[model samples]
Target: MGGQTAPLVWGADAEGGAPYVFYHRESGELVGFEVDLARALERRLGRPIVFRQYDFKRLVDGLERGDLDLVMNGLEVTPDRARRVRFTRPYYVFRLQLVVRKGESRCGDLACCVKAAARIGTLENSAASRLLADLGAVALLYDSQVTPFEDLQLGRLDALLLDVPIVRAFLPHWPDLVAVEPPIPGRGFYAIAVRKEDEALAAQLDEALAFLAATGELRAILERWGLWDQGQEELLPPGFSGSLAVSQGSSPPAGASPRRLLTLALLAKAALVTVALSLASMGLAVLTGLGVAVARLYGPGWLQAGALVYVEFFRGVPVLLLLYLLYFGLPAAWAALTGTPGLYISPFWTAVVGLGLTYAAYEAEIYRAALQAIPPTQWEAAASLGLSPKQTFVHVVLPQALRLVLPPSTSDFVALFKDTSLAGTITVVELAKQYQIISTSGADFRVLVEAGLITACLYLFMSVPVGHLARRWERRLASAR
Candidate 1:
């Protein structure tokens, strides 16, 4: 959408992992088949190719928004997607691969996994995920390509169905994992996707792809990444053996409206999860925080120091890192300590505990401040009433501090509600993740916008009442005073 002289901006997800667009560990540079192909396309078009990172699910939305000229990641050719954007000629052919832990025997093949209703992991909105759905296997969707393999090794997933390229790239690093022979049935094509109206850009990209294929440059790129094979032959001369009907402007099929309704329902359900997670986390935060605050203010010197360390350490670490540690690291640590192999924690509770612990530190500080804000005369008054230390603290100091901290506590609860989106990283599939999944599956940009608006409104619906209650309580306390 930029001027002719502007760089051709392409979108990709570096977290998509190797053989696609991913960061090179040793060199600390982005490198992959797509990176090489983009460079080749730049040379062919005589324009600079600029790479922009995005979540793989949002790449199409970026294209629709005119933020990117095209997306060249491992975007597949699908009818739902075809209705949204024009795809370049198929650049690479890929097949779904089923992976299992090295000694797994219960579900060795796709059929076996399907028959067993085994829990299979795959990328959200991917062909493999759809296949799992059709086959009646329980599908666990992930945002990152490499995470399924980790879950497979951890026994969290019974099997993993993903693109062959991803399996090839990651299997070397996971010796305990193996791909089933003869990958899943059917093949998919990876291509560049452009906005539907970008006919000129699409033509230029197709021309460049034809040239690359003819001159063996495309094969060289794929081969360099260990991705070239007989499947790639289909992309050679006479160009794009696959059907080109997707390039034509096509509307979503009739009765697609129900899908939007279903999407809304999913979002609603996820919003409930968000509310429950946030409320539980806040409750835990309040209780733990009160204890820590009391320890820091009134406990023995050693206990106070310990409470201080807890607050500083939790406050310093990021919540996302904490979620990852609690979800993945904790089990591994438990295994090492107790010589147990499968010490797993469910994603929901892990999110609750991780969020609770991280926010407890902030809650501790808030309560501490509110407790300190109480005047010395209040304690003297309680003492003059012949109240014991514990009774005075409980009956007078605690109640006043609770009232003072109400507004800030409400603010933290709202913040924690939004922070629940981070739970998606651990595969909790709360409101934000539901929006992403719906956006990826929908055929229209309007659908994306609508889903996003609905998500935002739902968040507000849950958070606004807490704030109103806090204000009402503040006013009542003032009136009573």
Candidate 2:
């Protein structure tokens, strides 16, 4: 709502990668076609461009929240999107490009790729993903555009379907990869998106676009980026003449009830996965923590030092980094060591082990403190009863320590449940990931809200009961004492 003289704030995801917006390899400067376009728009509009980094999936939400004036990171013009935001005249036209390893022969074209049921990877919630779903091909969705290509090279993905600009920018770096020709049919237009209510801003942006297109400045920018083609010929002449009205013809289908129910069912199923993962991870944490605590407390000096190092190291590193290391780094390291190409662990197990190992460091501290809290009198009493040191520790000290640790352990479990969301980065679609997918593909803002609310409720439903149980146990223990 600032005056016309204020800097125009635009949001984009650099992680979406080159030709759109990414760091240059040599200079490390932020460079892309969109960056150039933003500069041109700034010149035409008489305002400086202020760039803001956003996650690609959440860019629209950022716009809705008034965090950005527009989003220009290769954003596509689609009827569904138009219903939510006003788009300027299309700036660039791109087609989906299919890519496979150089020697791949099973699928030469889109149809052959689909017919072969190739395991294809694409940006999540994208046009290509919807196309793959409609064609019944196995589509793996990723947050970052670059990671999918990495997976393809690692033999984890058979091929990748992405925009032509991305393929063009990245293909050279990957010598073993080649884009399939011709580019997939149908065209998508990239345009700057402004919030639906910003009519004044949208109009101003349209005017700037028209001026850029008319003066041939836009074409020059695209050409410099190697994006200018026949598509721009169709777009430039008619600049800014398009209607702004949201088209009713492209509204979501009448099967809302069924779709909602199915979405709910999928969320519920993902909630179960979250529960199973949390439980398994917590179990491992508890067992590993007890061993570390026992070693630090009672083992030889070398063993105690080792346990201290383990606790300090894991506790210092973030769990998300741990998951990434286990899921992506470990496999790469293993392949380098063994010369085996496909030495990857399943995402679910990788998440389990990563989360388990991370929380164990915290759990060790809790167990160590609880053990120390046990009074010296208890050990003495057990010894007076003719019990051996091991038996005294187990029958007397351990039982009291369990009571002391229960409340904290229960709290840790609840925290661990929420931390499971981080697993999505490694492609384990727990409740949070499921909600993200549903919200992204949903027809309207209402769907985003409803899916979000349901996801939150599911998390509470899983976590609240455990908290209540712990509180009840605390009360019982206080009364008994």
Candidate 3:
């Protein structure tokens, strides 16, 4: 991950990005306003620009880890971010636009949306979320900018708050959606981010940016993408002070007060969602595992081979990949192949199916091992007693096998609970996503520390009860034997 001595690496996430830094649809080559700006900056510094792609939420950590020398991913200039990294002059100034489904006249502006108590969607850790939170709206935080629009199209959300450039880029493609009037004023500006320790590099980037603005080169790049607007002209005038282009955010200082209690309550609710998802997924996994184990043990030869392959395939692939496949890849494939509108699976069922099928692979092995561990004599004895094969298995073998698999099954369930955190990627508001939204909106890092502590405690709390029950059942079964 170290790139300090190499070409100047800039981190960006291409997903959900359009005119910012994304691949051209027809050419399939990366080209965007930010991409061009990065190249120009690279030339100014006498270094090649190496673009390292990452998830939008991960850009900050990537920069902090030295995985990138700079981040030019439309990273917003905020007081909270300023504490952790040095930001170059504002390269782009943007406002938040409220997008709604066309012909929906319930809310015409941001104020009306808030007054109606609508379910608003926005990027999870952005200034938009902070605004929604202040407005006391039910903010549906998302990892990608696209999902909010998709949800809006389907009537799942009342409005979407996103950057003006993003709305302009995606709106033309979605005829059913339109931007509501009175766009939210600029909350901040986009800037290149440098690690706080790399002050010299930050200064150099700031100088290059100032020069670019003065020469109109930056404006040209933005204009080519149809993103040049009065917002940039007013916020980042030519030859402006790059070092002090923006100051502290308008939001009040973050601290521990009643807000801490509110955050905890929200985390608790999110924890419940995590638990419910884990329980449902575990239920499906157990049933699937039983079917898989039985197929491998007693079914026809081909069925046994098929079951084995299923187990191996799922266990080998990562759960996150499985989720993406089910949530995004499958739907797109279905739409393309059938020439139909894209299929949209509810986030809840998507999480259940993805986690369930993936864990079933491991559970199948656990069940098979337990069944094999039981002596063959029990089956023979039951057969000799004139019991039918099905009854013999149900009455004699199944009970013992259940007890044998209990402990490990409990362990797997515990693991499944924590893995539910990955559901955040598909737009599920589980504990981890809630933590992210809360942690980012505030400036104090200690609040995040407190949030982390509570998360660990919650995991421990859930696992301990299951472990105790498993031990109790095991001892009872042992004594009965």
Query: Mind giving the per-residue lDDT tens digits that candidate 2 earns over 203-319?
Result: 888888876777777777766666777766766666444323221111111211111222577789889999999999999999999999999999999999999999999999999
Better of 2 and 3 by lDDT: 2
Q: Could you tell me how far off, in angstroms, the CA of residue 217 lies in candidate 3 after the best superposition?
A: 0.3
Q: Kindly give the number of clashing pairs for every candidate.
A: 0, 0, 0
In model 3, where is the ten-residue run with the lowest total lDDT? 249-258
Candidate 2: lDDT over CA atoms?
0.78
TM-score of each: 0.53, 0.53, 0.53
TM-score: model 1 vs. ground truth: 0.53
Quote the positional error of residue 273 for candidate 2 in Å. Answer: 33
Q: Where does candidate 3 stray beyond 4 Å?
A: 1-5, 235-481
Report residue 418 deviation for candidate 3 (angstroms).
18
lDDT of model 3, residue 79: 90
- Displacement of residue 224 (Cα, Å) in model 2 is 1.1
RMSD of every candidate to native, in Å, equals: 19.3, 19.5, 18.8
| Tens digit of per-residue lDDT, candidate 1, span 116-176 | 8788999999999888788778999987655576678889999999898877776765778
TM-score of candidate 3 on Cα atoms, chains taken together: 0.53
